[model samples]
Target: MSAATSRPRLVVGITGASGAIYGVRLLDRARALGVETHLVVTSAGVLNVHHEMGLGRAELEARADHHHSPGEVGACIASGSFSTEAMVIAPCSMKTLAAVAHGFGDNLLSRAADVTLKERRRLVLMVRETPFNLAHLRNMVAATEMGAIVFPPLPAFYHRPQSIDELVDETVERVLQISGIGQASPKAWAGL
Candidate 1:
């Protein structure tokens, strides 16, 4: 089915950052919401996912409607003509952020992100790094200036989340909402 007729398409990129669960949960949640997903995982991303979640590449790729190799620079997503609502790099590594910040389309993931930005589509970078150094902060600023939302998956205590799943789900829900594909019942912060 065509994306417009059936479901909105979202490009998901998973980098080598520590929080692999964010990317995985994003795929699952987007599917539940009937959104078509195009996944691209870097090699380091695959390794980290396996190390963190014990999920192999095939297992992880199975969560999405379509998956692309990082080296597939000629993939449909690499072009601006490809219609996609938005692209989110969940757990975006510092290296990936630098590439996107500098307009370096070294691979499919960064290339797709560049396309997303040039097309004026939403490109959310869920950067996962602690102890932000100068370069990391600068790259984030550069990406933000270029219309990429640099989102860090920090837990919110306002929701009083009881479990890790709840925390992750809440964060993913926020991301979906930000990407303009929000769920029917999104959790809102009712001021205390």
Candidate 2:
């Protein structure tokens, strides 16, 4: 069956990274496209949303089709058999990135990510830290070697984004495009 005939399920993990809006916008796009989303957020993720996006917990949770607690290790998405198309940790904190790299699943978000990797499913981690130390670089390499896509939400200036929202939407669109679920809002380059 085609994608339209079957509902695509995506597990979204939001961490204590600086770009909480990336996660929120991903949810909005997924919802708009009729995709099923399972959301899990670390405590710091919620705090980041309040600080960065000025959104409350209820408001953030309201965007997703389902919400899973970070501490809820037994959540359905934590199992390999749950069958999600992809798991994206938008604005993934370095702490969580390290955990996933070292095979540490101390919470629901990491556990779900671990399950995604072990299941050979697409696991996209938008690691959101800069000025990388050797350790951070190594962790990113390790995660990549283990099948997780270490995507940093870098702004593409070629899009000539007029506002922060445009930048965010383009980044979210690019990430979701990996799962064939969202539109590419940025103008494409026809030739180099």
Candidate 3:
């Protein structure tokens, strides 16, 4: 049995944030569902994932079908014709959020996201900034207006996850839903 993705390419990225596990679980789950994944991690994302999720770059790299340097400007993903269905900046940082919202595309991740939005393809950003300021809220609104989903990693208590892994998985699942591949491995949820 294999994943049902038809030319289904998923672009997964990690940014500097506290919830690196969200990005990890999203990749893991995607792999289990047999999605061909392209991964890019910012330098800040590498440090943050080590400090927060305790996962090394090698581990993250292993989960991806193709790994592109965050700073590399020549990766295939920087262009729109690479045949990627969507891009998810899981645990999206404020910096990356602003970049994508404003179409900065300074880095490969942001550029890929920009391409996603411009092509009208799905782009899901799991924005993790709490105590949102006016600027953050406005960016979220702006990104949404530009056809991007700014997902905040707020967990629901209805499922009552027993451990941190479950909490992380819940958030990943929530974020994955917007990616169109979420239904492939959905767990039990309440209220249908």
RMSD of every prediction: 1.5, 2.1, 2.8
Give candidate 3's error at residue 29 in angstroms: 0.9
For each candidate, give its TM-score against the true structure.
0.96, 0.94, 0.91
Answer with 1 or 2, whichever has the higher lDDT.
1
Which lDDT tens digits does candidate 3 get at residues 88-131?
Answer: 99879998989988999888989989988988889998888789
lDDT at 138, model 3: 89
Question: Which sections of candidate 2 miss by over 4 Å?
Answer: 1-5, 182-186
Clashing pairs in 3: none
Stretches of candidate 3 off by over 4 Å are 1-7, 187-192
In candidate 1, which residue ranges exceed 4 Å CA deviation?
A: 1-4
Residues 1-192, model 1: lDDT tens digits:
234556888999999999999999999999999999999999999999999999999999999999999999999999988888899999899999999999999899999999999999999999999899999999999999999999999878887899999999999988988987855255888986
C-alpha lDDT score of every prediction, in listed order: 0.93, 0.89, 0.83
Top-lDDT candidate index: 1
Checking candidate 2 for backbone clashes, the offending pairs are: none
On the 0 to 100 scale, the lDDT of residue 69 in model 2 is: 93
Give the alpha carbon lDDT tens digit for every residue of 1-192 in model 2. 124437788999999989999999999998887788999999999999999988999999999999999989998898877878888999899999999999999999999999999988889999998899999999999999999998899888885789999998988888887755644354566665
